[model samples]
Structure formats: C-alpha cells, structure tokens
Target: MAEKELLRISNLVASFSINGGYYAAVDGVSLQINENEVFAIVGESGCGKSALALSILNLHNKANTKIEGSIYFKGRDILSLGLEELNKIRGRDIGMIFQDPLTALNPLMIIGAQIEESLFYHTGMNIGERKKRSLELLTQVGIQSPELTYHQFPHELSGGMRQRAMIAIALSCKPSLVIADEPTTALDVTIQAQILDLLRRLQKEMKSGIILITHDLGVVAEMADRVAVMYAGQIVETADVNEIFSNPLHPYTKSLFASMPDAYRNARKDQRLPVIEGMVPSLLNMERRGCRFAPRIPWISDAAHEAVPQYHEVKPGHLVLCSCYKNFYLKSIPRRVSSSTLR
Candidate 1:
C-alpha cells in the first residue's frame, strides 16, 4: 500500500538577485515526501542544497529572494500563505533542525526557555505544563539529566549536547515534517552516528516525514529511504537509497562516488582520492538554457545533451535528468586535465 503524501513541491524556483539580475538557486525542482519516510537531498557545498530546504517553508527574505511555483504541504499551498499563517506552520506543522546549533540557539536564553518558546507559540499549555514538556523533550532526544540540561544555557553544552538540544527543540512540537539540514556537519564520526540514529528513532516514533539536506552521502545511506542528487541549482538524479548507491546513472553522481575515500580501498597506496573537476559555476553565471552539467562533461558530444533536459526514468522509481549519461566516462581525459581543456 502507498503511504500518504505529506508534502509536495512542484516546479519550485528560488531565485536571488545578484548585483542586478536574478539567478535561481533552486530551479524548477519538484519532489514529494511521504509520511514516515526520509527524503534526503545531497550535493556539494555550492550546489544549492540549503537553498532548496529553506525555500520549502518560504523562509527566505522576500525583499531580495523571488520564489516561484507551489509548495503544497498537506494539500495547502504554503507559498501562498501570509506570515501569520506561515508562522503557525513553521514549528508546529514543519520543524527545522538547522545545521549550526550555536547560531540557531540563543546564547542568552536558557535551553529550557528556547524549547518552551515553540510550545508557547504553538500550544495553549500553561507555564508549568510547558516546562514539564520541555524536560520530557530533552530526555526524548537522548540528553542525560534533562533537568540539569534544561537550566543550562546553550553555551554550556558540548557540541554534541548542543546539537541534541536543537533536536529536542525541533521535535518538541511533534511536527508532521522535520527538515534536518546538515544535522551532523561538524560533529565527529561517533557523534554523527548517534545523531543520525536519534533522528531515525525519533521519526519512527513520531511518524513524521523528514527532508534531510546534506552533502554527506554516508549519512544519507544510513537514514534516507530515497535520495535526490542536486548540482548547479537543479536535481540531477533521484532514486531509492539502495538504487542510488548500487546503480547511479548521472555523471555527477558517478563523479561524486569516485571522489569518496571509502570507494577506493583497492587503489595504489600513493594514489590520491579522486576529485570532480571544475568548480561549481556561480549562480549568476549559470547557463539559462540546456543541461546545467554540459560544461563539466566535455567528452560527451553536444548532440548527446538535450536542448532542455529533464528527468526520465531509467529504472523503476529512479530518474536521471540528462540523456548525455548514456555513454559517460569519468576518465575520458587524463588525470589533472584542466577545465579549459574540457571546454
């Protein structure tokens, strides 16, 4: 049986103006997150992963950012909502676990108050009840000594503990959809595992859909049910997590796998970890037409690329954006070849 859809984003384009003209950070992206599943978006630093996540709730500054298309959450178009209406949905309906705990959490406010802030705005609980709920939330997120942790300020907690506190706050309202953006970014390997585990367990308990935005494919492998690979402000491929790992089709996806350290265990001891050549193009400089990845893949003929490429399913439930992936090769040119040569 198919699970109920929780959120549906259609032809969403989030654009920000450069010096004068605007460029898309999320260009005509469409996706859906089912109830009780994790939909992970993975890409390199400048590939607009974070932009897509923030755009879901219309969180960008309207003064400069121009958002087009619809973001329908539970059948209502979130893009059309006013601030008062959107405020109600931000925490209670859709919670966001921001990447930086230090910046997201208030230094002056006690951790308990921070959690209670969401409760105060969203729920009609009394002060005593709110405090009790806050304590329970801290405990639920795996923080030991919830009472003590509640009284401490955000500055007092360790990096891992602070991140846990952030999780506690996001889940305090028991939102239907949780957007965890790079939740394990700066943490050590051990803490990263713990954080991911906690998110999985909490999602199962709360029965919430999750939009996990991160560059770490390892984390995606551990937690995501499905994955979206983004590059140059557009999603290049999307598939079931197992299928993405086992049978990736996009050239960008293939290049990313080659660059991972764990995928090259059998290589020569002196061989360096592979790298995807060419810096991500500036948003202002991105081509207005054709495949966004065309510049990086020079070996493939121009005819291989569609004038306006769009995702087509290559396997069941797996979509690749470009036809040029048909005969792609990572080693078409020698190692250390320059981007100029590729062009």
Candidate 2:
C-alpha cells in the first residue's frame, strides 16, 4: 500500500549572502514526506540540515537568505506564498519544533499562553477553550503538572520539560506535518529516549508526517521510516531505514556508520572508530560540481566520480548519489570494502 504524500520539496536551494555573494547551503535538493511517516535527515554539523528545515517554513531572513524552491505542502506552494498567506498555514496545518527550547521559546510568556497563540490564530476557540486545550496538550506531551507548568515561564522549566512544552506548542493544532529540527540535541541519554518515545507516541496518535532533522543515526534507526544522508548541502544517500542500516551505499554514509562507537564495539573492540577526514566545506568554499564528498575520500579515483553527480538507484527505493561509492574505502582503515560490504 502507498502512503499519502504530505509534503514535496522540489529543487530546493537555500542560499545565504556572504560578502555580497550568495552561497547555496541547501543546493538543488528534493524529497518527499508522507503521512504517518517519520523522514529523517542525518548529517554532521554544517551539512545544511537546519537550512533545509528553515526553508520548508520560509523562516530565513529574506535580507540575506535566498531561497529558490517549490515547497508544496498539501498542494500549495509555500515558497511562493506571502508572509500573511504563509502565516495561515505555519502553525495551523504545519508546525515546527525547534532545536533549542531555551532559544526557541519566548521567555516572557508562560507555556500555556504560548501554546494558545497558535489556537488563537488558527482555530476559532475562545480564551477559556484555548486554555483548556493548552493544558490538554501539556498533559499529552508528558508534563507531570499541567496546571503548574502552564503558568510557569519557559525559564522555570528543566531542559526536558522545556522540550516537552515545545512539543506541545508544535502539536497544539494537530498539524498534518511537523518539522522537528534536532528535538533531542542537548538532552541526556535517558531524557533523549523519553523524548523520542514521546514523539513516537504522539506521531502515531496524530498520524502526521514528520521531518526529523538530526545528526544522530541512533535516533534515525529508532524513529525514522525513511532516511536521507546529507553531505554538504546535498543528499548523498536515501533509503528505507532498514536499507540504510543494512547497506549504506554512499561512502559518506558508510563513513558515518563506521564512526559510530557502537559499530566499532560490535565488530571488534580493538578497531578504532573510523572518522571521516576533513570538515564539511564552508558554504562559500563548497564545490558546486562533481561529487561533494570526493575531497574527503581522496583514495577513490577521480574517474570514480561524475563531474555533476546524480542519484543512482542501486535498488528500488534506495538511491546513492555518485559512482565513487562503488570504489570507496577509508585509507586509514586497513580493510578495503566493496559496495556490498561497505557497511
């Protein structure tokens, strides 16, 4: 059975102006999110994960940000909509749970009022009804004392509690789509698990599509239905969650798995955790042609890469960006792996 498509982003380019020049942070990327599915985008920092999320909501500052893309949400082009027009959909039909609760939440307002703001704007609910719904949302997200938490300001809550409040706000309208950008970044392990569980439960209940942006593959394995491995503003690999875990085709994707401490412990305790050499290129310096990951994996021959890399479908629903993945092997690691054994 086919899942219902909720959002479709086509040739999305989110660029930032630097020194009078615009540099594409999210360059020519496209993907789809379906109803009742969690689509995870995983990559290291500065790989344009957040940029893509911001572009979805048109949240970037227009003065310095150049976004050329069609973000079709429920058949409407979000990029083409004006601020007022976008506002009608921002928190009503689509919601966002931002990374840092401290920064994302308005400190001045109490939690309940913050959630109510969405209800006020989107739903024709009175003050009494909004308050009632706010408390319900707070309780639904696992706040122990909904009444007390409701009146308390964002500064008064713990990191986990603040994150819960953010979740409440995001789900207040029962949106069909939610963009959760690093929802568990600063939390501890136990709290992270709890948060993930809460999100999973809520998503199941709502049956909404989610764009979960994070660098943690562990979170992806646990929560994602589909996964996209991003590298320097482009998707290098994408597949069903099982396929990504079992057979990560892109060299960058394999390198990410190899870097995980658990992968080393599971394979051989003596083996050092493999690290991808070199940082993601600065936006201004990022190569716009060929395989963006080639420089980081210099052992692969130039002939292995396409001048302008395009997606190669290795199997149905599994896509790898370039031919370089076929010949990729970490020079530092003693073992050389074929495509089948890359993971």
Candidate 3:
C-alpha cells in the first residue's frame, strides 16, 4: 500500500530582497513527509532550514520576501490558498512550535487561556468545554498539575515548562502535521531529552507527521524516521535516518557527521577531525552554474565545479546530490575510532 503524504514541498524558492537584488534563501528544495512519520531537516545555523519551514506555513514577511513553488497539504496547494483559508489551516491542521517558547507565547495571557483560545477558534466549544480541553492537553503533554499550570503566565513558568505549555497550545487543535523549529534550542540537556521524548510519544499516539528542523544530529537520530541534509538552500541529500547515519554519500553529509563532537572526539588522535574547509558561500553571491558545495569539496577538481551534479539514488531510498560519491564509494569514508580513544 502507498504511504499517505501529509505534506509535500516541490522546488520551493524563497528569497529576500536586499539593496534591489533578490537573494534566494531556499532554492529548489523538495521533500515529502508521510503521515505518522517524523521527517527532519538538519543543517548548520543559517542554512535555510528555518526559512524552509516558514515558507511551508506561509509565515514569511511578505513585504521584502518573495516565495515561489508548491507546498501541498492533503492535496491542496497551501501557497495558493487565500489568507483567510491559510490562517484557518495554520493552527487547526498544521501546528507550529517555534524555537523560543518565550517569544512564541503571549506574555500577558495565561498559558491555559492561550491553549483554550485555539480550541475556541477551531472548535464549537464553550468556555467551560475549552477549559476542560485545555487542561487535558496540558496533562497530555506531561505537565503535572495541569489546572495550576494553565493559570500561570509565561513569565511564571520555567524554560522547560514554558516549552511544554507551548507544545500544549500547538497541539490544542489536534493538528495532523506539526512543524517544530529547533524545538530544543533553549532547553537543558535533560529537559531536551524529555521534550524530544514527549514529542516522539505524542507523534506516535496521534499518528501525525512531524517536521523537525534542527542542526542537532543526536536529536535526529533519536526522533527522525527520515532525514534531509540542507545546504545553501537546497536538500543535498535525504535518506532513512539509519542509512544517513550509517552510509552518508554526499561529501557535505559526511563532513557534517564527521564534525559531530561525539564522532570527532572518538576519532584516532593521529587523524584530524574532518572539517569542510571554507564557510558557506553567501547566498547573494551564489552562482547558478555548478554545485553549491563544489567550492568546499576537498578532493574535487575544477572540472567537477563546471555543473551541478544531478541527484542520484545511491541506495534503495537514499538520494545524494553529488557525483563524488560514485568515486569515493559510500563505505570508504574513514571509520570513527573506538570510544576508548576519547578517554
């Protein structure tokens, strides 16, 4: 049987205009999220991961922004929807949990009231019913003393609690798709683990698709069913989480994994931590002719920089956007040294 696609984005292009020239921030990105699966977009900061998420929800600032391409949700092109229709779908069908809970939540409003507001707007519920639903949501997200927590203002809650409240509000409408942008950014390590666990549990129970946008490979390994590595506004590689971690094909993907602290520290003392030399090229100065990563490829020649390599399937479900892998063979990348080397 065919898996159901909850969200499908194709050739999405998002740009910011500065000094009369438009610079593409998210260019030609395409990916799909299946129902009941967690799809993650992983990249370093400013790699257009957040921009891609915002474009999916049509939440970008339009005065200085230009967005093009299709974002389809349940067969409807969300980009084509009217403002009124889009607004209705934003929370009711597509919930969003931003990176900072403090900024995402209203300072003056009580957390419970905020969650209740979504229920009131999306469902035909009275104040009492909304309150009941709000408390239920609070408890569902693992907040103890839901009644008390609901009445507290955003400033009254701790970072982790505030984040939990934000999750409650986002899930209030029982959205079929949740877009969590750096969901664990401000959290402590323990709290981060808890939040990721909660999200994983809720996603499984609700059978909803989740788009997790973060640079944290650990988090991706913990929660993602599939992973997309974004660089310079394009999805350079995508594969099942296991495949991505075990057999990354793209040089950029390999570089990212090699740079992970745990992976790097465990490497042999004689071996240098694999670093992709050169900073990400400025999007404004991006050349349309060759691979965006060509400038950073350590072993490739000038001839390889002449054109953008076509995305090729290197495994059953894995796709890499570079031809270098054909020459490097997936298994030839140096293996990580034993954990004993770290100590």
C-alpha local distance difference test of each model: 0.91, 0.92, 0.87
Candidate 3 local distance difference test against the native: 0.87
lDDT, model 3, position 239: 98
Model 1 lDDT tens row, 1-343: 5989999999999999888788899898999899999999999988888999999878888889999999899999999989999999999999999999999999999999999999999999999999999999998989999999999999899999999999999998999999999999979999999999999999999999999999887889899999999998899999999999998889999989777877535874756765666779988788869988888877778999999897889987899997988988786335676788885
Write model 3 residue lDDT over 99-182, tens digit each, in one string. 999999999999988998888878999988998898899999999899899889999999999999999988999899999999
TM-score on alpha carbons, each prediction? 0.95, 0.95, 0.92
The reply for model 2, stretches above 4 Å from the true place, is 263-269, 333-343
lDDT tens digits by residue: candidate 2, 1-343: 6888899999999999999999999998999888999999999999999999999989999999999978898888888898999999999898999999999999999988999999999999999999999999999999999999999999999999999999999999999999999999999989999999999999999999899999988899999999999989999999999999999889999988978877434566566678888789998898888999888888888999998898999998899998888888765665556688767
- The runs of at least 3 residues in candidate 1 whose Cα sits more than 4 Å from the true structure, single-residue gaps closed, are 263-265, 268-270, 332-343
Residue 273 of model 3 has an lDDT of 59
